[model samples]
Target: MDHEDSARFAFLHAAPVIGGAALLKLPPLLGALGDGLRGPLLAGSVAAFVAAYLAPRYLARHFEHRALIPFSIYCSVVGLGSLAYFAVT
Candidate 1:
């Protein structure tokens, strides 16, 4: 996609998370936490948010794109493993 299209896509993807943080999480977190801990909590959450947002972009940029086979295999393995474990139990 072009630059504007990419920006729009990112914004569209991010708006819900950002809006939820502002409207849902932030108010409750601020109210529940004290002044001493709020700064650290907010900073850590921002760091986590940034990492989660950028990690996929970094992986996509640096790695050869393999669509979804690896993920599907992983899910199948986990699902079968869980089924086996439950069956045994």
Candidate 2:
């Protein structure tokens, strides 16, 4: 496989795993927007997007292949971190 093929393979393998994590992370802020805090949602969503994208990117760099349990844990941990951050300050 060439570089493009290899890169595409990596991205395809990771898409759903990363997507699962990203969507979960987004809900907290998006949910809040629907309930209230509509104005700040743009900022919140951006922050969540950046974090979610970056987290899986970082994890994928280490893991290469996406394993289900680890991806789930990664999502949960990121969600918890987002919640904790919102909780604290």
Candidate 3:
């Protein structure tokens, strides 16, 4: 797929997560936390969403010409660590 298709695919995948969090998760969380904390919680959630949305774009530019070896190594370590943890547990 081209760049537009890739972006559309990313947005489609992300929509469900954002929708689920806003519709299914946020209400219960807000209720449990009470009115006093509602503003801060919502603000924090928006900030987190913005950060998550923007971070990849920023990182993509920074790593545009970099080697993928570091990322591959990091993924391997995490995957093995997870496997080990699950096997022991």
TM-score for all models, in order of appearance: 0.51, 0.35, 0.68
Off by over 4 Å in 2: 33-89
Evaluate model 3: give its lDDT. Answer: 0.74
Q: Cα lDDT for residue 68, model 1? A: 48
RMSD, candidate 1, Å: 5.3
Q: Write the per-residue lDDT of candidate 2 for residues 4-67, one digit (tens) a residue.
A: 4554577669778967886886677567456665667677668967876676566556555554
lDDT of 2: 0.69
Q: Order candidates by lDDT, high to low.
A: 3, 1, 2
Give lDDT tens digits, candidate 3, residues 1-89: 64444544676688788877679866776785576878887798889789878766755565556655787899999999999999999
Compute the lDDT of residue 14 as modeled in candidate 2: 78
lDDT of each: 0.71, 0.69, 0.74
Task: For model 2, give the RMSD to the true fold.
Answer: 10.8
What's the CA error at residue 83 for candidate 1, in Å? 6.1
**How many pairs of residues in model 2 come into backbone collision?**
0
lDDT of 1 at 19: 74
Q: Please list all clashing residue pairs in model 2, or write none if there are none.
A: none
Candidate 1 vs candidate 3: which has greater lDDT?
A: 3
